[model samples]
Target chain A: MYRLTGVTKRYRRGDETVDALSGVDLVIEGGSQLVIQGPAGGGKTTLLQMLGGLDRPTEGSVELDGTDLARLPEPRLTRIRSESIGFVFRTVNLIPALTALENVETALVPLGLAAAQRRQQAAEALESVGLAEHRDGLPGELSGGQRQRVAVARALVKRPKVLLADEPTGDLDEDARDEVMSLLEGLWRAHGLTFVVVTHDSAIARRAPRLATVRKGRVAVRERGPAR
Target chain B: MFFTYLRRELRCHAKAALAVALGLALGIGLVITVSSVASGMRQAQGRVLQSRYGLGTDLTVTKAATPPTRGSTPTFDFAGQSGSSARGDDLVTVQGSRSLDASVVSAVTGQSGVADAAGGLSLRVVKADRRFTQGQARQGGDATGVINGQHGFGGYGGVTAGQSGGGTAGQGGGSRFDADDYRAYGVDVSRPDIGPLTSARITSGTGFSAAQADGRVAVVDSGYARRNNLAVGRSFTVSGSTFKIIGVAAASADPAAEVYLPLHQAQALANATGKVSTVYVRATDAQHIGTARSAIQKNIPGTDVTTSAELAAAVSGSLTTAANLATNAGRWLSLAALAVAFLAAGLSTSSAVGRRVREFGTLRTLGWSSGRVVRQVMGEALVNALVGGALGIALGLAAAYAVSCVSPTLTAQVADAPGSGGLDQGGKAVGDVLHIALTAPVSAATLAVAVALAVGGGLVAGGCGGWRAARLRPADALRPADALRPAA
Candidate 1:
């Protein structure tokens, strides 16, 4: 579970102080799915970053699983990100130098898994995303959708409690987008994961049981489906 | 993990590795070749000096020769001289005398450092024509010295050669034909005090007995013997005396001594009887050679006293140019080359890190700490250095061998240690001078120094690369530049 109490993020741009997020409060429960929708520069990614323990609030506090993430030291924050958080970006950010399976295996390195176990887990995760035959293919050699699937596999390979995706379908064709949406929903339902997606795609936002529309550094509207 | 990352990185950037390696190899190769040359010259010089000093005799002291004033000493009219003068004229020419005989020898032998002393005459026969034949049966044996221009044993000054005869003719027809000439030295090889001859490595016959006074026995030098077709026991005639050849000995410090005779006989042959010109002294211990040399110089004021070390140094003079280059210019050149290799490696690695920021950020996001990333870069540098050092050593040794093959022997003029005043100038002899031969040996010490240099260069470059990577923040680095706008 994650909680943000009156959280704010401010950055100095030369002579001006800009508020990336201000006076926002939110809570994310275990195994829950949340979608944040906003136009460009609408603080959607910042909100997701704060919830995922990637950044700290300028004031107030961010707590994840009962630990105050805003006050945590860098090392403990890094540990939380490594063991509990997984990320998928719009660019299908699998390392181009590694194969699909090896990219997934990389997330397990910090866990100190044996090489054999790591490989087995990576292969299984790739298979779960329907990329079993393409485990050995490099990101550059795979199609847009396959690369996105590889990214998804990499994220799930760690078996983190929470998964965060930012514009996951931004660069993919409609078919790849559809496949990624289906995979994300299936993983969320089957594995009891806490899923948070930041996107402008209305269809992805519609699929989430809970949705929050952000405007001007603040959440303006919240929606919950029957499933939530 | 470090090694795995290093392997993948090297494969991706092999060009950089090869470029650095090639640069290091060139510098290392030059250093090895020069070091080997200097080492070889030292070894060869050591051998020559050892042979020149001769065995058992640690110091040589010979009296200065008088100007013979052989022709005439010209008086200069200092008030506007008319004659043409050459550059670098000799001022204050010291007069020499054949006075280093009994008294001087006795004086040196009695000095505190002197353990023993032997004196002998060294001179050339003025009229050793063909009449210079075998000695009588009462003497040691027979005398038969070479007598021909073909043998390079021609008459000295204007001495005419005569027909070969049985000494009876020497009492009569002495100047009809031109006879060969021979440089004669008088020494008792059996006496440890008598240097030059005492250390003669006998290739054939034997030496004179200390008790034997027959005086007709001789020791022919190896080179002179080879030229004159003389063997042990062969009789030769010189200065009208026949000596039965005792042993064909290796040449002494001065290679031009073609014939060696008993001290008494040498005194008689040069017709300077009861007089010896040079006295060689032996010290009690090796370390005391210098002490003895100094004492002898002080005891016999006008004598040239040269110790074995000084003799050795004289041969080393031939390699003065090479030694200077190796010691002075060579060090700076090697350092510059190393600096070049290090600078290029650092700059290239820094640039490489700049290009791979996203990759590094990805590693960071995947749980690699900043320290681990720096270690990866450092490990890559160290591995490259090790490989490059190995390659450089191999290439360096090869270059040394190639240099040695092209230049095996180097010749230099031997300026006898300041003292050999009355002794023959060894360099003046035809076909003989101080020869410093070379054989480059790659000592393990040299290899160790080279390897250390290579490693040091690599570490320097690695440090630069690591420093560049240490300042990057993964979150900001991973984000695209267009995503920098203020969030809504």
Candidate 2:
């Protein structure tokens, strides 16, 4: 579970101090899915950064499982980010030099797993994403949809408690985006993970059981309709 | 995973890696070539010194030659000889050196740091053989005629007091004179290892035996022996005493003498029974030759002592110039090249890191520690350095080998430079000019230094790139590329 109390994030661009996040409160129960929607630069990605422990809030506290992430030391924060949070960027960002399988294995490296076990787990994760046959292919050799699948495998391979994805299908076409969304919906339900996604797509937002809209660094939560 | 990533990254950026390696290789190759040449120069200089000083002679003691008195020329008088031909010889001490007391050798040997000392008498023998017809008186009239057989103006016998009467000498009465001169060194047979004999290697027969310390046997120099048609078992007369040629010697560079004799016999011929022209001293430690020279000089005042270093300073020629170039300009040039190479490598690495900002940021977001990222960057840099080091070593070895193959001859004038006051201080010219082949030898130590430089260069380049990678923030990857771009 994550609890946010008066969360605020500020950025200094020269002499101007712009507020990327404002004092907004929210709570997210474990094993629940939430989709955040907002305009460009409306603090959508900033809010995701806070939830993933990638960045600290300027004011107030962000508690994950009752531990305040904003106040945690950098090493402890990194450890929590490594062991508890998994992130998927809008860009696939797979290492171009590594094979698809090796790309997925990178996430498990921080977990200190044995090489054989890491390989086994990475293969299984790739199989789950339907990219098991393309395990040895480089990202350049894979198509747009296949590369994103590798990224998804890399994110979920470590089995973190929370999966924070920033514009996961923003660069994909309609078909690929729907395919990725369905894959994420199925994986979330199967893993019982706390899934939070930041996207501009209304279709993706409508399918979430809970929705949060961020504007001017403040969030407004609403109960969502039934799943599509 | 670390290795795989590093390997793949280097392969992806092969051009950049190769550029860095080639730069480092150029620097290391220059260093090796310059140092190896310098080492070869030192070896050549040592050979020049050994020519005159001999193998074990570390210092030499002598007194400056006294100015010759007027009318000191050798005279040949054939008076009261029964035969038609008369032969006579004169032995003179070597020029540019005065005799030292024979005891000076023992005194130098007793000095601190002095291992052994031997005295040698350097002399020159001038042999004159002449034939003359006895003057006969003949009567003639008028114009004064010449008489060529007599000594004192032919006795002016061509004219009489009253009438001009000519006196004609007998037919075939003109005198013929033949002269020969050769250098001879008197060796201390008991301790020949520390004297002039050390400079010559006997090529035929046997050298002096201990029992023959005062014997009438002599060793002849090969060149002089060939000229005189003298061989072992042949006899040569010096100052009316005959000595049997027992051996022939050949010198590597400067032949010390035309003939070598026992000290007692040479002393007897020169009429200086207890005198030596030079005292060659050997030191217990070659490194302490200066100390031994000082001790010998202090023990015997008014005597000049010369060391090998003093002789080297007196040498001048192309060899010295090349040595200077290798030591000064070559070293500085190599160092400058290396500095530039290292700087280029560092800047290139830093630029590579900048281009990979997105990639490094994504790795950070994936929970890779700062240390792990840094290690990956450094691993790639290390591989480049090692490859460059190997290439540099091969280039250096090839360059050195080529130099040896060419073997250009360098001329060195040792210990005979004008205005070198050392000559008067018992430092004799070993050879007026020597031709030594230049060689570049790569020593083990030079290679070791090359390897160390390669490793150090790698570390420097790696540190630059790793610092940039380690400072990246994981959150930066979450923002859009344009969003993170700073406002201009």
Candidate 3:
């Protein structure tokens, strides 16, 4: 579960102040899938970053599983991210040098898993995403869809309480995007994972059971729909 | 984890690692090479002075006889202008009449810890040929015949005969020879324990016997014999008295190109009966050298005693003044090594850190503590330094060996001899040259210098990188791919 009460984030741009997030109040129940749909600068990525405890708000409070993220020290916040939050980036889909399996294993490094168990878990994570044959292939050697699948495997390998994906399919084609979205939904259903995807695709946004639209650094709309 | 990271970093930055290693190798290699040469040369010079000047023993004593003092009265020119001229003072004035008898020297020999004793009569001898005037000849020349008989001449005519022939001569010639004079006086040649007068290497024959020791036999140095064409088994008459040449001795630091003979024979030949100018005494062991010296001085009364080590030190001090010019000349090489090492580390580390700025920014955004990041970077630097230092040490030692092999003059300077044949076999083990003769472990001081350079380089790198990473806004780091903007 995550909650943000009147959260505000401001940046000093020389003489003017730019509000990245202003007076934002939101909440999500456990095991729920949410998509924040917005344009490039509509603060959707900012909201996702705050929910994952990667950044602190200047005002108001962000609570993750009832713990205030703004009050946590940096190391503790890192621990929270390590144990409770998994991130999927659009560009850095996986570390370029590491294989798909190793990319998954990297998420387990902070978890203090044995090498053998980490390897097994990483292989299983890749298999779950139908990338078992490509487990040892580096991100650079993989197709765009495969890279996105590896990123999804890496996100799910840690078995975190929440998964934050910032434009997970932004670089993929329409067909590859559907496959990536399907893989994400499959993992979400199989493991009961809470997903927050920041995407500009309204079609992908409509698939989520709950959708929030961000405009001008504020949540402008929220709607519920059947899971697709 | 540390090693893993180190290995990864090294693999990724192979060029930077190699650059650092090469810098360290050259720097430390030069240090070891130069230090080895310097230490080796010092030891070599020390050995030459010690062996030639009788520096093996601990004590020596000369009879207390005041040197002649210059008169205060000024000399007058033809104009009757009375003034002191630089040449007016006779630099070679001889004085002191009180001489120690052989018995007194023998008494010093009887003291505890006294290993051997030698009595010497020092006098300036004028050469007959004047080809080499003012040459010093030791009263006895018998020992010279036993070692390098080719160099010793028997009689006074034999000296001229040997000189004219300029080759090996017939035995028992008993000819009056024209060899140079100016000899150092010592006890019988059979005594090997005498301080400061021990024969380093016998070029021709055995030392003098008691009969020849008390007789007219003498041992001349190789330098004097070579110059005068003296040979063994020849007799040379001095002052109308014929003396046999038994052996020829090599010249060392003994009285600046002098010859050697039995003390009594020299005393008899000099016509200064019952006079002893100096005495050589050796201590039984190093520890008792001082005690023996003090006891001899006390017994002799009014005599100044010195040790062979003290004499060697005196000679070394004099020689160091001349050699200081050479040592100072090599300092520029050391400065160059330092400069190369410093610059290499600076450039390599700066470039490496510059490339990793984005990675460091990501780590900082991921909540890595500043201290942790600093430690990680410094750890990488330490790894580089240690590896580089190890390579440097190996290369330096090899360079030192190569230098020694290439330059025999350097070996001679280090070993204190021409051949250095015995030096190879003399110490505990061969090629153990590094430990005693060349570079000792204490010479690892170069490693510390290297590490210091690396640390300084790492700090600069880390500081620049950390400053750049810390200036990044967290929002930019966490933004979506399309939304994220590069930092100003």
Candidate 4:
């Protein structure tokens, strides 16, 4: 679970000060899905970064479970990210030099697992993402949808408590985007994770049980009906 | 995983890695070449000194030769000489060196750092072979006729002039003579280890024995012996004394004498019973030669002392110039090249890291510690440096070998004692210019230095790249506007 109270993130662009997030208070229950939607220059990614402990708020506390991530030291925050949180980004940022299986193994590297165990777990993660046959393939050799699936496998390989993804399908076509969203929903239900996704795609936003729209550094929450 | 990533990255950027490696190699090669050539110069200088002073002679003491006075010229008389063929040999001190008391050898031996000393007499032989014939006087105007091969009938004819009509009979008889001259040294037979004989090797027959110090025996130089067709067991007359030839010696490239005789015998022949032309001294400690020379000069007045170092300093020509260049200009050039190479490698590595900002940022986002990132960069740089080290060693070895193969000859003109035409060691004129072949030798120490420089160069380059990688912020992973977009 995550709690944010009066969170504000500011940036200095030359002589001007822009507030990426201002006086935002939000709560997310555990094992639930939340979709954040916003336009360009909005605070959607900033909200997700705060929730994931990737960045600290200027004047608020971001609590994950009972710990305030804003007050945590850098090493502790990195540890939390490694052990309890998983992140996926659009464009599927994979090391071009590594194979698909090796790319997934990077997530488990920080866990201090033995090489054999890391390899076995990475192989299993590839199988779960339906890229088992392409585990030895480089990212450049894989199709767009297959590479995204590899990224999903990498994010979930460590089985963290939460998954934060920014524009997870922003570059995919309709068919590929639907395939990725279905995979995420299945994984969320199966693993019971606190999944927060930042997306501009309405198709993904409409499917969320709870959606938050961010505009001008402020957020308004809405409860949705059954998926339509 | 670390190795896998490092290997893969290096393979991906092979061109950049090769550039850095080649830069380091050139610098290291130049260093090895310069060092080896410099070492060769020093060895050549030592050889030039050894040729003149013999293997173990550390210092030499002598008195400068003085010009002869009006009545001091040597004379040879053949009056009432036996047989129609009369011969005489005159022994005198070498022209360029004066005689010193034989006691100076013992005095030098007693000095500090003087291990052993021996006195040697340098002498010259002026031999005259003449034939006197009685000629028939003509009862005419000149009353002279040529007898045997004489040019003028001067002496014998005049003696008979009083009995002749015109008394011109003395001008009819004359003599024909041939003069032969050669340089000789009188070595102390008891202590033959420190004098002129140390520089030569006996090729046939034995050298002078201690029992022959007072006996009439001689060792003839091979060059002089070859010209005169002389061999061992032959006898040569000097001042009415016949000395038996006991041995034949082949001298060094710069020979010191044509013949060697016992010191006592030489002193008797020269009519200077207790005089020697030179004193050769061997120091107890070679490192303190200057101390020994100073002591000898202070204790013994009016004596000239010369050391190997002093002789080397007097040497000038191509060898000296090459030595100076190797030690000065060559050293600085190698150092400057290395500095530039290190700088280029560092900048190249740092630029490589800059091009990979997105890659490093993703690793940071994946929770890889900054330390791990730095190690990866360092590992790559180290590999490049090691490759460069190996290449540099090969290049240096080849260059040194090439230098040795060519073996360019360098000339060294060693000056003699001040105002003394040359060192009168047996009147051979010791300090003439010599030609020596130059060699480049690469020692193990030079290779060790090259290895150290290679490693140091690697560390410098790695440090530059690693520092940049460590400062990367994970936030750099997200593009501006904080929204993911398709690649252009």
Ranking of all predicted structures according to TM-score, beginning with the best and ending with the worst: 2, 4, 1, 3
Residue lDDT tens for model 2, A125-222: 99999988999999999988889889999999999999988888999999999989898889988998999999999988877789999998889999
All candidates' TM-scores?
0.69, 0.81, 0.62, 0.74
How does chain A of every candidate compare to the true chain A by TM-score? 0.96, 0.97, 0.96, 0.97
Question: How do the candidates rank by lDDT, highest first?
Answer: 4, 2, 1, 3
Q: Higher TM-score: candidate 1 or 2?
A: 2
Q: On residues A13-84, what C-alpha lDDT tens digit does candidate 1 reach at each position?
A: 666777778888888788988888987877787787787666677777888888998898877776777788
Per residue, candidate 2 scores C-alpha lDDT tens digits across B250-279 of 755555568899988888887779988888
Off by over 4 Å in 3: A226-228, B1-5, B48-177, B181-343, B360-379, B408-488
Task: Flag clash pairs in model 4.
Answer: B153-B171, B153-B172, B157-B169, B157-B170, B158-B169, B158-B170, B158-B171
Q: How close is candidate 3 to the true structure, as a TM-score?
A: 0.62
**Order of candidate numbers by DockQ, starting with the best:** 2, 1, 3, 4
Question: Which model, 3 or 4, shows the larger DockQ?
Answer: 3
The local lDDT score (0 to 100) that residue B35 gets in candidate 3 is: 61
RMSD of 1: 10.9
